[model samples]
Target: MARQLDLVDFIVGLPMPVAASPQANPLDLLPRRPKAWERMVAHVPAEDVRISISTTWTRVVVEQLREDGCGDQLRANGSIVSHDVPPGLIWPEPCRLILMTATSAARIHKRWCLEEAPGTGLTNTFRFARQQHADRAAVSQQLRLLGEGQS
Candidate 1:
């Protein structure tokens, strides 16, 4: 006859590793911030434009111009400004705005296209739509270009 094991018996038979000290706080599991992030935060203004680049991609963030409804005016003028930003990317130093050329915008669009997965149809479509908005911003003289060092 075969030997059948109960729940407690099976659990007892399983190998267990030695236990370490428990964490005092859950936040202790979070990774430490990089030195670059500290430097950038110290130098950059909250209201300025910032571009963060990584090994695989780049991200642009434009802070909302709250004083005198300037952000609203910019939006009314068809500017491409976004206040919503995802965390994790470290922003560079604050920069002055420079007019973005259509050529440059096109290059940016091409880069996004290359980076996006071709298999993700819906995601690709959404990204393409965003690229079109950027292209429109370039045409409307509302797109701003960041220098290489700023990124």
Candidate 2:
């Protein structure tokens, strides 16, 4: 028959150019930078850290759902055309939209940047990753040296 869509998700998926589409969601400005995107990065409780969505426009979806009053038209002859990227929409960053007409669902994955993670004192995520790599290298070197010396 026809597919169903949630208004919230539909609104969130709309592209920029579409007149009926959603706004330029500030969430894409995740983890802010230069103190400009600070507000978007949220402080998850008891985590000692912050989290944000991607700034990259990887996941962007177009709307195909048409509403005539309270009901929405889901399928175009029970085919996938019911889920199309509302024509003439373009996002600033690179993005991809996936429409699975069989399920009538749209999924988006976009890129983003963060402001700071220092608020929780565990903001050294990158530093920690680098340090771990260095430490592993040192350990590997030590093990190789010990093996060579013993052999």
Q: State the lDDT of candidate 2 residue by residue for 1-151, as single tens digits.
A: 7977799889988886746543343334222232321222232111222221222313232212221212112232332233233333332211221122211110111212212233222221111121111234432343344334433
**Where in model 1 is the C-alpha error above 4 Å?**
1-68, 71-98, 113-151
Error of 2 at 31 (Å): 44
| Candidate 1 structure quality by residue, lDDT tens digits, 1-42 | 999999999999999998965523311211223344333333
TM for every model, in the order presented, reads 0.17, 0.16
Q: In every candidate, how many clashes are there?
A: 0, 14
Q: TM-score for model 2?
A: 0.16
What value of lDDT does candidate 1 attain over all alpha carbons? Answer: 0.30
Point to the candidate with the largest lDDT: 1
**CA lDDT, every model vs. true structure:** 0.30, 0.26
Return the top candidate by TM-score: 1
